[model samples]
Target: MKWWLIIILSLSIAFLGCEKTDKPTINEDGTKDNGKLESGGKNPKSKTGVWLTDWNDAMKTADVLNRPVFVDFTGSDWCIWCQKLEEEVFGKGEFLEYAKKNLVLLKVDFPRDIEQSEELQKFNEQKMKEYEIEGFPTIVLVNSKGEEIARTGYRPGGAKEYVKHLQELLQPKE
Candidate 1:
């Protein structure tokens, strides 16, 4: 009886630890530490519609293209909202075309299942600290020098509306 209860409790705790499948949790410092991210490296001109996970590479691409960097800080594998945003906005043709023309896309992710290189994990953790990331799916727009110009998160809308929202955010405020 007592042994059975203890065993069940332990199993529950084990299952609940790390990357909550039912709910999203943030650390005391407001950083997301769940899910996983995969690398998607490709040439900007290829127009294959993917993101670069390397920070330095993204900056270089932005410089070469004279464009801002769209940095997506996400828990790509576990964050439900992140997945929805990708499906409803990022993966669509409207945003893809807009992004291809105007931005160098970068993905910095905190994942659970996948094994990120130690260097990559360190670099990404440092970036989270530098950016003061609050939660999964935080998006920051930056210039070629990698200075942030604007920030936003998951918003309700499809790709076309999302493009409009981005256009508004990109507009110069006088």
Candidate 2:
């Protein structure tokens, strides 16, 4: 009888310890219910559009819109360079506008501070392995067919320069 009680208590503690403390509830519209913007509450709604957290949904949107997928591999709560990129480029108006018209944005986050759902965590891990991502702030461009076109990381300068760099990388070779 004592052993049974001990086992139950141990199981309860293990389950409680594994539970997430800060998991954000994602709405059906892909917005977070925690009153925070997808990119750590930097921008609300922009002309560019919202950054999607789901890979399959982003791919479907890209297929329908005929736009390429821009996947941002970020560590939103931990990586300094990721935060810098988010502030300098992704959070800027110019880049938002460019993204709205040209790209389908997807954010795959591996955060040390934020608690993500188990599904999101697993998916991000799978993508990291698939893309061979070695660092935070890795940006991968994929065509509608889900083929990788280009890859880049944190760059100096603001939104406009980053936009131009993306444009150049996306341009077809002669």
Query: What C-alpha lDDT does candidate 1 achieve relative to the native structure?
Result: 0.82
| The best candidate in terms of TM-score | 1
Model 2 alpha-carbon drift over 4 Å, by segment: 1-48
Each prediction's TM-score versus the true structure:
0.73, 0.72
lDDT, residue 32, model 2 = 59
| Reference-based lDDT, residue 64, model 1 | 61
Candidate 1: tens digits of C-alpha lDDT, residues 1-174: 999999999998888765446343564436453432223433335422459898988886677667888999999999999999999999999999888778888999898887899999999999999999989899999997878899998999799999999999999989
lDDT of 1 at 165: 90
Residues 41-75, model 2: lDDT tens digits: 42222313789998877876776667889999999
**Residue 152 C-alpha lDDT in model 2:** 99
Which pairs in model 2 have colliding backbones? none
Best by lDDT: 2
